[model samples]
Target chain A: MSVTAAFPSRARAWLRGLLAGPLALLTALLTMMGGALWLPEGAAGLDHLVVPVVFFPMLWAGWFLYACLDPRLLRGFAVVGGAALLQLGLILVHLMAAKGAVT
Target chain B: MIKLPKQQTQSLLAVHGWSGVLLGLLLYAVICTGVAAVFAKEISDWSSPLSRPSGQELPTGFDAAYRDLARQVDPLFLHEVFLFPTAGGRWNVLFHVDEKDAKGQPVERGTEFELDPKTLKPLARRDGLLDEIADQRRSNAVADFLVDLHVRLHLPNPWGLLLTGTLGLMMMVAAVSGLFLHRHLFKEIFTLRRRGGLLTARDVHVVAGAWNLPFAFLLAFTGSFFSFATTIGVPAMAMVAFNGDIEAATAALTAKKLPEDPSPVTPANLDALFADARQRGGARVGFVSLEHWGRADARATVQLEAREGGLLNTAYLYSLASGEFIREQPFLGHVPSTGNSLVLLMSPLHFGNFAGVVSKSVWFALGFAGAYVTLTGMLLWTRRRQEQRSWRIMDRAVHLVGYGLPLALAVAPYAYFLLRDRGPHPADTQGVLFLAVAATLIVCAAVADDLTRYRRRLLAATGVALAGLPLARLASGGIGWSAAWQQGLASLLAVELALFVAGALYLRLALRRSATDEATPAAGPAMQA
Candidate 1:
């Protein structure tokens, strides 16, 4: 490994660590909140609320483990960030619809 | 063995070691306190026993007592009423109304009464905000102290809950990574080297960690769910779905609704309802809640204990006006669902109270092993880095918390017994004493020449404190062993005997360690590395 090549690799490693630690945490939290909006309510009409609340820990743990173990750093970032964005969009749409209904 | 790529295995190993190294001490504290807290109910009863053990938590005349308490509470605060059993077989009743505070935040103000279950006589009364009343309870001071330390480490509010929840997440990471890192799981479960050093210690940590991985994962998942559910989940859901109206979100989630019928109506026979609930559920009634108590829209919910050999309890709803059994209801919603079942499983899995003493004993042993894994992992990690100054400081801290925390916890019951009658706020006094002892131990840990001496002294102190707790209880108006036996207080007697035996065991261990230290000079502080 040449010095010039090693520098970029080290920088990428640092970026991966940052993404796996804090960004992963933020993504999990957003996903949980967004899941409450987007998830289907089961026959009892409580899956939307109860499922997210009960399995929040599992959701976070899964994300954390995946974030740390992914071999490609950019792919990990794209997946986590894209999931977070999707959830955020769902939540925003729901809130907008609710506000429109009220108005 | 489950095979994995080398690089992925190394990644998991780093995650495992770093997670344990970073949060290991706090996790150990939480697990150690949690082991004691698994028997929190029995501890409460043992520490603060009534004159005689009541046959049932709620006796026959509880209806009359409820009516009497109802008359004393303000009519404006009659929206909801709670009746439950507290420590020492005391019945606690709270009448409250939820209203917005000055800052548009929800708060509950109520009048609470603690009654002796045997006679239904009022033992203590408080009228104030619900949180204040909760802070003033003293009967279960010792158990509450242990539980609070486990739950939040006595830190305040959402921050404490968040910190503990993070610790739970870290524990989950450690357990999961440990499972993958140890490719020889089955083999390691039976592997223990007799050579006493880092290798032996490493083997023990791996074996215990591997054996406890599934349980640790379950505990971590459930514990974090509990910590975050109220602190973050509900509020965040409310923010998204209900426009931040927590009360509305709660009502919608519970699926309970009653039309506003303010006509004053006498409640139907509560004793009959209790009897029917007990017969139907085949369990003791643990809690009773009535909403709109004096109105035509009144509804009463009776929560029963877990039936024998069952993990979940059943709740029944009744019309307070007609005294008719409405239906059986799940805990979270109007009907049972997968979500409700999962939520129900969390409590038993985390607390290990599903099968009474047998389950609790199993939980205690497993939790102790979890604590051991945490402490040993930290000791091993720091021992490897003994050359680094920061790691050396951390080594001392590991010893301070590992040995010192148990001593402080053992001494708290003493403070509880000694100050119960002599002080105005025994709980607060107990907290101060707990901190004082911890501070003293920290100083001792720093001043002592080596880890061995510090550990020995702390263990000896813990042994003395634990052994003398029963005498302190006896001196502070508690019943003696003879009276306990005569009255069939077997649980209380067992607890006292267990404490004495544990104390003796700890003292013996400390003495043996001290003798070994004297015989082998090389085994003193050098062994820590």
Candidate 2:
């Protein structure tokens, strides 16, 4: 195969690898962190924190499988990246609000 | 079976095989060690037992020892105290204060005392950071070595944990993919061909893999939880929730809140509390934690083993001053909730210690099957591509690790038994010897003309090492079999006999393989696989 013909396929493969590996991990972690903010704090006021940590493996696995199995690479990127950004934004907002209240 | 399109099936197969090929060796090591680690307590008892059997019941005079140690240590170190049993039912009392180190990381600076459960006499004492003190331990070195290898492959913290956790993820991928890849998973579970060829090799691997899928998934998920809960999860969660204070985050999740009254109040007798906990829990106390000792706000939490047939542990909270039972404690939080229940389930599920020896035995066998599937899968993968020189070399590397690891592990106990007393720390000595044997095996594998001979030699060596371990123990002051039988040291006898039998079986198989090799060199690839 010519270089130009091979380039797109190789690039797509590398992108898929990145999405399935590191990007998926980042999304899982961010989701876990954000869970403490959104998840209900049960009677003990720790359900949100404890539950997310406990279910971390499942969350990571889910994201990883979706990343690997999804045919539309752009959709995979959008869903994972969008969820990660959403959580990151929520975390920053929570921190900022807490800081404002403190100030 | 769950049906999927051809393209997806191919993707799943690729993921399954490549994941095994990439991380299978380390995963196999983890699973192999984990099989032995199921009997860690038995191994500890077998390696180092007291003259008399120390039952689960906490020995008397424990309070007196605690009081003596309390008076001896600085009051600052009395912020918290932990009491648990260690090798051979010895009481390990650690009085420590949690403090930040120079780098602002949490460290427990403590004085540890190991006491004889029978006499309550201090066998050893060390003062330092908790990790450092643990490094100096000897009595349970062999068990600790195996558990450490299973958990982290003996690498340094964070890195070792991360690597193992990643391996757990890989295992999760492999299990999930294998499940999706197999169209006849149900049939394969019961289908094993006796025909001696590649077909039988594939059948064995598939059968074992199919039967072991759920267990593999369970182990992988729980193992990953344990590995990452502290390393990544706790730290990241702490960063968000507790301003990077892991201790504070841990306290919020696990610790019970009691009103502060710092005025000195005499603590209640530990023996009475232990007995009460035993009666209430219907099991022996496995761990005890004392917070704000000798103060009005002091609390003692007694964690007991799972009740007669239960899967979850029982923990009871007590007021240290009055010695009155406060409540039946959940693992996390004060009351039982979804989170606490899930967290409580993790330990028994992962360790398989809830049902005692029977459960542990089942878990060990399943883990062994998992290891077998992993090894056979890799061998078959290599065998299929053996026409290439690189694949042939991969075959040798696989054999070296697959057989050499067991050989090294079988030989490790020799160092522990020999140097356990009147020598350098047995844990360190075991590491050195394990590495030495592994190095030697690597060289042997490199120089060997035939892979079959090298594999058989390793098997024979492993057999000899295992068979001789009991002798080494007996020679190095271990109790005799007669004494063990008389004293009802069933665990010791069982472990020793198991080792000997396993060793003898390996020797027999090696000899048989040698005969087969002589009769027809490379007659059956199934045998090699």
Candidate 3:
């Protein structure tokens, strides 16, 4: 029993990972685009198209992604977050200084 | 009790995982952005000094500013311009525009211009106020981008709102599914092992998620309303009860609209009405609309409504000719109305903009925490994996977004002080801040390794930067301690205290990194990076 518990369970873990984050993002974006395209035009131009096109699919996709996270992606999220921060801070000083009064 | 097969359980768990995973990121963005948005006005106020473009002209007085529009703007656009005033803050001029026909739907356009404080000449800039700041920081664009990212990610309007609503639904799904997946929701609420593998990620996800359930739920429900009503709420209501007459349905939801008579004569007494508006509505009489601005046939109308935290979202219309209140549009005031009232309520609750400093501060802190929750979620997710393709890129992005936001936020006020004091002509305060913040985010995004260390560095910097902020105010001719001391320093103290607290929180999080690193040795090494 203990040996069974110790086994990689990589399938479960990987499948679990797929259900979260970027996977959801992809699904939602697709859903929104697809749904928007499907819904009858509200008036014309993009704004009308936007609501149905982007939102529903995204919403549905989120659920789907949660249902699927691709766990590998989860592992990298924070590390990438840290890198993004460093870049953000450096640019902020420049932006803050360039803009004059920052209030 | 019948136990489902393990595979079925895993599938259900997968259902929860996927839906919940995206939620943590999106919700974090929304929460953080929403939090930052709460202090937007205050940040702008703080940063306005830097916004002083190169000019020496005193801010345009309300009367002159009002008269300028009276003379300059076409009569059609002249209901009245709501000047935000330039007392170390961005100037916003808003008036309702006549869209379509007279009996047609009236559209309100909030045209924000960064004015030369010296000349009172309008500055051509977009993204008005906070958005302007975002634009400059280029980081602001990221924020706007994040906002877009958060709510529909710039998918267009109602659909975007609907998308966010669906996201909100997913948030709800994640919340619910999360509960089901976690056998120990309450037990693990505050459990942060900072350990390795799935356990670490699990702790971060459950803890933050559990703690912020209220905020999370509110975010989803209110956010969804933006698109949800048009897509779901309104339609659902119509289908069930109103027979699909959305307009009629909306009218019934709020109070009925009185079709005022078309008086052609422009009003003579805007001053009296404005004074009365202040008296009746208290200080925050935000809305001023002209029933009709142009043509001898048009009557000048001024509509004054309450801002958030005040008594009413209701407005009263005064015909400039008849200065007396024509009639008041009564709002439920904190009470929810099915139609417009619901719309009115959404901004305050979602943005947490409805309260005084204390409430806003509470919201701001929560928002910051929410940002952390997202950062941790991503970190925990990624930490579980030893290696992968594009891991570094994704890791960098998270750091950029997470640390970028606060770094930009802290830098704004500092930038404001330096810039405000510079060049004779005050620069555009909002614009300057945005530019600085953006530049900072990009550079930080490019260089940072372990986002936590970056966060710590930024937090320490922010705390030091803020410590000097109050002193700078003293050195400059801003409201000093003597002046503030008399007024109880309520406003000043409130803002500073909030900033200080925010700095402290960041510092604390940074301090805790070591403990967390012990759990995940890879994380410890990454922290140095």
Best by DockQ: 1
Identify the candidate with maximal TM-score. Answer: 1
How well does chain A score by TM in each candidate?
0.81, 0.91, 0.40
Query: Tens-digit lDDT track for model 2 on B436-476?
Result: 99999989888877777777888899999999999999999
B-chain TM-score for every candidate? 0.95, 0.95, 0.65
Worst 10 residues of 3 chain B by lDDT: B51-60
Model 2, B391: alpha-carbon shift in Å?
Answer: 2.5
Q: Residue by residue across A17-94, what tens digits does model 2's lDDT show?
A: 899899999999999999999999998788898899888988998898888887677888899999999999999998
**Residue B149 CA displacement from its true place in model 2, Å:** 1.0
Per residue, candidate 3 scores C-alpha lDDT tens digits across B1-529 of: 2344565557556565555455545555555656666655454444333233322222325546555646654454554344444324334454434354365754444344555545556654332233333333321221233344455644566676755665676666655555556666677786777433435645665677777767765666666656555665444333322445666545554432444555566445555666776667655444444544433333333334345555336566554555666555534211222333445666667776556676677776666655665566666555544366355555555556655655654554444455444552122453467467768777875677665566567656666655666665556566655555564534455666666776666566556766544442225235322
- What local lDDT score does residue B424 receive in model 1, on the 0 to 100 scale? 61
RMSD of each: 2.7, 3.0, 13.8
Q: Over the full model, what C-alpha lDDT does candidate 2 score relative to the true structure? A: 0.87
Which sections of candidate 1 miss by over 4 Å?
Answer: A1-10, B102-104, B196-199, B514-524, B527-529
TM match of model 1 to true structure: 0.95
Chain A (candidate 2) TM-score to true chain A: 0.91
Candidate 1, A1-103: lDDT as tens digits: 5323545877877877777778888788788788777789886787788788887888788888999898777778899999889888888898999999999
